[model samples]
Target: MDSSIITIFLPIALAIVMAGLGLELTPNDFKRVSKHPKAVLLALFCQLVILTSIAFVICKVLTLPPLLAVGLMLLAASPGGPTANLFSYLYKGDIALNITLTAVNSIIAAFTLPLIVNFAIQHFMNDGQHVGLQFSKVIQVFLIIIIPVCLGMLVRYFRPELADKLNKPVRIFAVVFLIIIIIGAVAKERSNIMQYIGDVGAATVLFCICSLVIGYFVPRLFGISSTQARACAFEIGIHNSTLAMTIALTVMASTTIAMPAAVYSIFMYIFAAIFGTLLNRYAPSVQPSIEQAPN
Candidate 1:
C-alpha cells in the first residue's frame, strides 16, 4: 500500500468534497448553536465516551492486530460528514441541530481526530508495530481537511449565491466518489475479505450500535427534545470512514488496517436506517409549543 495514495489523493478528494460542504454552509448554521447548546454538548460527550469505551473493549477482548485495532478506533474518532444532515432530514430529525452539530464536529475533528488516532495507535500498537505519527503527516491532514474547509467558509462568506449553486454538484460527486471507493476497496481486498470479515464484523456491529444508542439518548437526558436527540445520535453515530481508510492505506500502509473502515462504510447506512425507523416508532412526537406553532 502506498502512503502517498492515502495521504495525498484521499485527502485531496475529501478536501474538495468538504469545500463543497463549506460553501453551502452559512453563518446561520453556526448561529444555530445557541438554540441547542445542551443537545450538542450531550451528543459530543456520548460520542467520545461510547466510541472510546467500545474501542478499548474490542481491543482487549478480540485481540485484534495492532493496525486493525487502531484503524477501528480511528474510524470511531472521526466525526460526521454532511451526509448526516441529509440523513437527519430523511429520518425526520431536527435538521437545524444536525447542521450545527456537523459544523462544530468538523471543526473539532481537525484537531481531536488526530489526537485520538495517535492515542489509539500508541495504545493498541504498543507491542512494536507502531508507525509513529510524523508531524509532516499531521500537516498533510490539516491541509487535506482543515485548510480547504476554512477556504470554503471564506467563499461562502464572500460569494453566497455561487456557494449555494455548487452544493448540488458537489453532493453528486460525493456520492459517486464514495461508491467508487467502497467498491474498489472491496474488489481490491476480495482475497482477504472472507478471512477478515468474520474477525471484524461483530466488533464493528457492536460499535455501531453503541454509537447510535449513546448519540440519541444522551441528548434527551440533557433536556434536548427527542428530535434534536435523534439528530445528534445519527450524526455522532456516523463516522467518516473515507478519512479513516485514507489514513490507514496512505499513512499507515496497512491494508489490514483499512479493512475495518471499508467494511463499515457499507454497513452503516443499513444499520442506521433500521435504527432510525425503530426510534421513530417508539419515540413520541415532539410537538412545537403553541406560540411557536406553524399556522
Candidate 2:
C-alpha cells in the first residue's frame, strides 16, 4: 500500500505477468481465430456485451456503493485471465480456442476496458472527482497491456527454450504478486473490508456464476461443441482479476475500487473447479483419454 510499491513495484509486477501471458501466446494463436470464426466472435460478444450488461445489472440491482460498482464493472470488462488456458487444458476443453480467445480478448480489452470504466464512473460515481481513464491513461493502459505482451511474444518467437524456462517462474511471481495486491488492498481498507464483503460478496459470486454459465451454455445453445463451450466457459469465467485489481489500485488509485476484484479472485478458481467437475461428469465432450481430465 505504500506509494513506492503502488507506483513502482505493482506496475512492474503487472508487466511481468502480462509478459508471461505473452510467453504462452504466438502468431499461430491469432491465426487460429480464423479457423473458428463462430466460436471466436460469439466469445467476444459474450465478454464485451453480455457479461458486461449482466455486471451493470448486478451493480444496479444490488445497489453497490459507487466505487464498488465501478470496480465490478471494471472486472466485467476485463479479458479472460491467462490462467484460462490452464483451466481449459485441465477441463479437456479446446486449448487452441482458449489461446485464441485469450489473445484476442486481451487486445480488445485495452480499448474496451477504459471505455467501460469511463461509463461506469460517469454513471455510478456521481460527484466523485476521479476522472475516469482519459486519453492519456488509455494510452497508459494500452502500453501496460500491449508492450509487455509483445515483448514476451518476441521472446517466445526467437528463444523458445528461454521463454519456456522463464514461463513458470514468471507465473509463480504473478500469483505471489496477486496475493500481495489483494492483501494490500484489504489492508489499506481494513475497516471497510468486512463491509465490502458484506455488500459486494453476493454480487461477485453471482457474476462469476453467470459468467461461467453464459460462457458455456450460450455457446452450446448455438450449436458449438461442448469442448469449445468449456473453453468459452473458463475463458469467460476466470477473469483477469490481477488486471482489474491493478487498474483499480494503480491506475484509478482507489482501494475501495480494488475491493471487488480482490474478493472475486478468492471465488473464481473454486467455482471453476466445481463447474468443470460437473461438466466432466455429465455433459463433457472431451475425450476421456486425455491425461489432465482427472488432474
Best by TM-score: 2
Candidate lDDT scores, in order, read 0.75, 0.90
Once fitted onto the true fold, the runs of candidate 2 whose alpha carbons sit more than 4 angstroms away are 287-295
Q: Which TM-score value belongs to model 2?
A: 0.96
Each model's TM-score, in the order given? Answer: 0.90, 0.96
Native-referenced Cα lDDT, model 1: 0.75
lDDT per residue as tens, model 1, 1-295: 3456555676677778888767766777777666545666777777666677787788779987777788788788777867777778777788777777777877777777778878887787766575755788776666667777788888899988888888889889877767766666667778878777787887788778877888887766766677777788789888877767766666666777778887788788888898888987999647452123221
lDDT for 77 (candidate 1):
76
Model 1 / residue 212 / CA error / Å: 1.0
Q: Each model's number of backbone clashes?
A: 3, 0
Name model 1 segments beyond 4 Å from true. 1-8, 287-295
lDDT of 2 by residue, 23-83 (tens): 9889988887766678888889999999999999999999998999999999999999988
